[model samples]
Target: MASTTDVIAAPAPAPAKPPKRPPARKMVAWLDPLTLVKTGIRSAISATIGKQADRRLLDALAAPDVKPCDVSVDAAGRPRQELWLDYVSDLGDGWNSTYAVAETVARPSLTLRDETGATHETRGGAVLVFGGDEVYPDASLLAYEERTLHPWTCALRGQRPPPHLFAVPGNHDWYDGLVSFMRLFCQGRTLSGFETCQRRSYFAAKLPHGWWLIGTDMQLESDVDQPQVSYFQELAKQMGEEDRIILCLAEPAWLVSQVRPKEGRSYLENNLDFLEEQVFGKKVSVFLAGDLHHYRRHANPEGRQKIIAGGGGAFLHPTHLPRKEAELADGFTPRKIFPSPQESQRLCWRNLGLVVSNPRFGVLTGLLYMLLAWALSVNLGGANVPQALGLVVRTALSNPGIVLISTLVILGLMGFADRRFGRWRWLVGLLHGLLHLTAAFLIAWGVSHLMGSLVDLPFRSLGRDMLSAALIFVGGFLAGPTIMGLYLLLSLNVFGAHPNEAFSSLAIPDWKNFIRLHIDKEGHLRIFPIGLRRVPRAWKRGETAREPEWVADPRDKRATPPALIEPPIVL
Candidate 1:
């Protein structure tokens, strides 16, 4: 043994390791101002979307735990009254486009006071079921309360005895993650002393009497057939003693727009089958909603009724002009003329259909539309190829300048309704004239596009398009708009309230006028004027005019009962 120490050969003298440099100081964390701005926008958008998703639900009123003593068969199994709510939607100006939200909120109180007067007062307290889209734009409680104040405070307070109020959350309510909606509507208070009931965003409520009000959170999720069906089964089970249950949805588009092609990975249309089978086909007694921002009813060919009452305090919506030439567009059926509903009936039903009440949609305050039109007209010199293309897009999207100007012109055309626009008929005339000029330019641009569609742009056509574009630009720059505004106007006989006195109500019609056209699957170019027609339904996808084919069977009725859902009812 070379010696234990030698054997360890040990530690060749540890080579002096170079002194390790101290770890570098950590960099200070920082936030970019641009990033902060982006975050705020995202937060706001998420909030709005949450409202769209909030479905102030109804609890499963079916209680197997009910004491046997509570059961008493009525002399007649059927309750004395059988109410069928035809349609319900957006009673409170549910959704909001940038244009008309202000008007909706301005007239909140008058909108929500159970206008259709209680169907009937029964021994059991009444169930006031809301179709959906209870709050407009966003589910801001302030907005909801504001709108509710007018309706309830003004008229509903007069009810000898107030009936129970049942509400269904629409997309706007569901938008802000439904937190506010759930807080105000579902969790806050509903029936008197019914605080103990589970405060789920969506649920069912049973009147002391035999009626069951089933409200579904249809907005957060597009197709609610399964949920609706499940509610039915549960209702049927609890319905042993209860009379018929009323199935209410916030938006009627569920059935009509059910077949729409899914856009941006959206499942909106796929659920139509479920809706049709469980709710529509199941013969759910009543349907009510408010998304069209106008009150109207389509008595379902199948006995069920569909109502769209988006006309709460938010804004009004108008039916567009009839297309003279029929062109096949998806979802387009020109209802140039429609039978107007009764004012009282509309009020009772919560639709913005009648002339007694309707908010006006407005235009940009800073002459934005006019300026944009002028820019395109002037810079492009009347119709540059690119400007023409852009104009085509604007027209297709229902150019605002065209709509606003045209509306002014429409008001002028009436010559008789001068009271409405007559206050500034000259100004209105000027605006409409400008609007018409813009419209003509836009139409010409569109025509070029149509021509381009028919024939590839030959060099000559290209040259002509370029020349036209330059002329448009020069004209727009000089005149602030083009000549011959292509626009459509609609009669407001149904929803426009005649102002009996100056400053009686909100001065909207004159201050704001515009249109948003939704060219359906048919070649029908239908306009929903901006201020009047909020186009409550946003992000329309698919061919504007074609009725989609049913990929899935919509009438399949086979399914498990809703009461037996896996999650036990917390209530």
Candidate 2:
């Protein structure tokens, strides 16, 4: 105060910088070596140890005894009268697909028309159900937080009267024995602007107008547990004969049972059949599920609907794969299939570019070729190409390590071969391995000849050896995946085998979809299957605080929005 001479006020502190937003997440590269190994190990553990531990200890400890929740009214205690719901599954894979679906889901309202050209407008669902596999490449706290929660949070942020959330655990969700899933979804926490209401992995909700939705937990395709049965049985006692039920499963066991009769029998008999005959009886009007990553619907003459709408951000599964039966054993045929069989078959052709689609897969194959080449130790300096290849074959057969690797490779391929192929799978897998060996041999020969002609350095010199190794690696990288792609193409198109492998390699970020349902005051349900053909790659921050923090950039060339996959279904 004494320094009155032009006392300059302290310079205003620089305006606090807005918190920098994190970089967007990319889609999972299913063919990445790390992803493959991690998922494979988790699948193995979940199938054996995790399943046992969960059944023996975890379920008993985590099972909730809370009564079924009734959502017949809003939080303000007004009668729902009518309700809307959004169902999405196999989500949490890529940022683009996840955000696209989330954006469509978060919209305040959507208007569309059915095949009859009757226009319909709907608000966002008051309740949102995650059908299954909430996170991809296995579920964990980090995976769920980053891949699932963040995208949804950014999409739904600032919304008023958030939708209630419920989920039934899928195989991936069960990988950690449902610990993270329990903490995130079963604790009644508000997640990403959604109010989670379930106190267990599976839930039952009583909607208005004598309708109920039941979600079941099928751990590793095992039978439904006793406590879950008791829970549902008790809930059923409250239902009247006029009431209709909607059954939600982690898988479509009806289709599974037809496609894979032997293994599918266990799923069908132990889960769907038991529940339908013993507990719910003939009251189930709709059966809904995910896990296949596509949309197909089968409706019986009596108007019962069986639908699989799994196109939720994961790579699309082909719908054209030949099944043992075109219709369910009970004579229910597909009324609608998205990406129709013709379109799905066309998409399968993309697998022919496997190396381009999955570069890391090519790198893994390249390293394997280099290892096999090193084991052979072929010297083609002045030798005939045929002789060099012969040497490779002999050395590969003679080396114990090489032999073991070859055997494992063949057996692994056989394991992946669809059981539909039966005994032919063994031969197919053997041929697949032999073809890879042939590719390595050819690559080795080509590299040796090329290096011999181009460089004058001694064969074993570091410079010459490094150059040769590099050439071998490059050749293997290109040829190995190309051969694999061609094999997959032929296998899927011609022999109808390796359907899962064929499409999974594509890692397609397009053809994402989800379902929206509205139960009208008249007790009629309308099903809307929404499809997004291409996800926007470029995104920009919201211009206003009321908007999501990130949104599809309108300037992006691929900014196509969601549309009806097929005409709406009213039942």
Candidate 3:
């Protein structure tokens, strides 16, 4: 070897650096703005003509009432007084979630055979009640065929006499004016062990013990059409004063109290008020709804229960962080008996990444600003276009402000969105604006330093001039993602995370969930929420149907033995 100092000259050639690859494609392709455009178009159409058009024709359509005897009994000795009803809501997404639902469908009798030895031993043929949203992402015939009908049909596996199918139109189903949903579910075609018996989207199923399962059509954000209201009004008149009814609505209106404290009562609340005061004019047993994509059972002191069971093959919604009773303002007592494994931190962190990185709108926003930074560096050098672009990227990175502002804005919007937590929202806004201002200054400073390293363009305080251009570009390109992220942040925080994840580009593998309502021989309704750990891809996974394992909290007062709330106990 040469002298020690000279040995540096013989340093081995550096290991060949690996070539950088373009960023990997997003996990979910449709989670982009293009899909949003398609859905937005459908939503706009529904808002305009679809809702109005359907209103005029409600009465013209038919709603058939199926009797108790029409459905088979739950077990051997069980009388017709007992009924088994399988309820699924916000269904029509994810293979595993639907697979879980299918397993229960394949073995409908298992629900009737409760562990408590609740003696209803007859062969119970359940009526499948879809709490709307049969198919999703526009609800086209293809969606229904692929996501809804085929999946359920495959699950049935030629089992004789499949459950009778009944559904109300959810917001997603209205995307195509319910045309595809009508054809697949409303039309009388009985393929795949399922039958569509109701010509209209809304119906009232006559249950045992003077009970009625009344479902109404809530078209988009509009009111329940006059026809639906009139139909229910008439039905209410015919029923006796003692008859208790289970009201089935597509949206959870009363849950608004969980989010917005000072907001006025929702349309459904007013409708319920009218129904109790004017229509049925008696004690409404339960108010059941799905749409929030989770399970919640709330009871008022007067015994009225508002149960939300939207966990049917959809990403589960995260429950709101528990706050003070005065802060919640919602009158119902939350039954903590069914505590989901979902945590707020995990939900928010995952959703924030998904919302920002996955959406095409968000990606484009990031890239546009990045490109602008490159462009700002472009005119300064005599270097070729490719070389200039690289320099621009380097300069943008040097500034650090671009990334800083983007992150601050996202965090600020998310942090301040909780209305229940008092007036911290203003602090978020103030800090966000200050950070943005700082970013603008840093952009100019970064330009100056970058130019110093390269050939300077013909301009005085060139970096200062660059600030104006940077601001202009940021104002335009950055505005979209900034605002979009803000909107998503507010919605995710306010809506409590589940709706964001359920409807977003990211797919979270949540536990499979549904509910079984069993009317015992005593005419009491017992609701069991079933949750499965995972989907069994093959039939050999288990011999029997899968059911939920209850996760009881010791702190839950309602966790007394048997867990049955005793029906006619009011919903």
Best by TM-score: 2
What is candidate 1's local distance difference test score?
Answer: 0.36
Per-residue lDDT, model 3, residue 93, is: 73
* Per-residue lDDT of model 3, residues 289-362, tens digit only: 88766666777666667887776766555555333233212367776423343454345445445435554555
The sequence of per-residue lDDT tens digits that candidate 1 reaches over residues 1-571 is 4865664545568677532321111111111224335444645776565445423223323232222111112225533232211122344432222112322222212111112332211121222344465554455667566444233332222222333345667666655666666666554354322222334444565432454445556555554534445544544555543253445556554433321212321444444345446443443444445544444433433344333444433333332211122332223332211113333222222222212222111111113334444444323334676766575556635656655655665564444232334356455556655464454455445444444554554658567655555544443333331121111111123223221111111111111121111212222222121123212222221122221111112232331111100111010
Instruction: List per-candidate RMSD values in Å.
Output: 23.3, 2.8, 15.2
* 381: Cα error in model 3, Å: 10
Candidate 3 C-alpha RMSD relative to the actual structure: 15.2
Candidate 2 local distance difference test against the native:
0.81
Please provide, for model 2 over 1-571, each residue's C-alpha lDDT reduced to its tens digit, 9 standing for 90 to 100. Answer: 5665767678888998654543567677777889989998988887887545655234545665636778988778888889998999899888888888887898888886555667778789988999999998888999999888988888886544578899988888988777788889988888767788788788899888888889998888556887887888888898999998888899888776544345535754567888998999988998899988888888888888999989878888888865444556455677887777788888888877888988998998888888777777767766687778677678777788888877787787767666767788778878888888888778878877887787664566787777777878888788888888888888878877777788888887788889999999998988898888888888877767677778787789866767787777888
The TM-score values for the models, in the order shown, are 0.41, 0.93, 0.67
- Best candidate according to lDDT: 2
lDDT, each prediction: 0.36, 0.81, 0.57
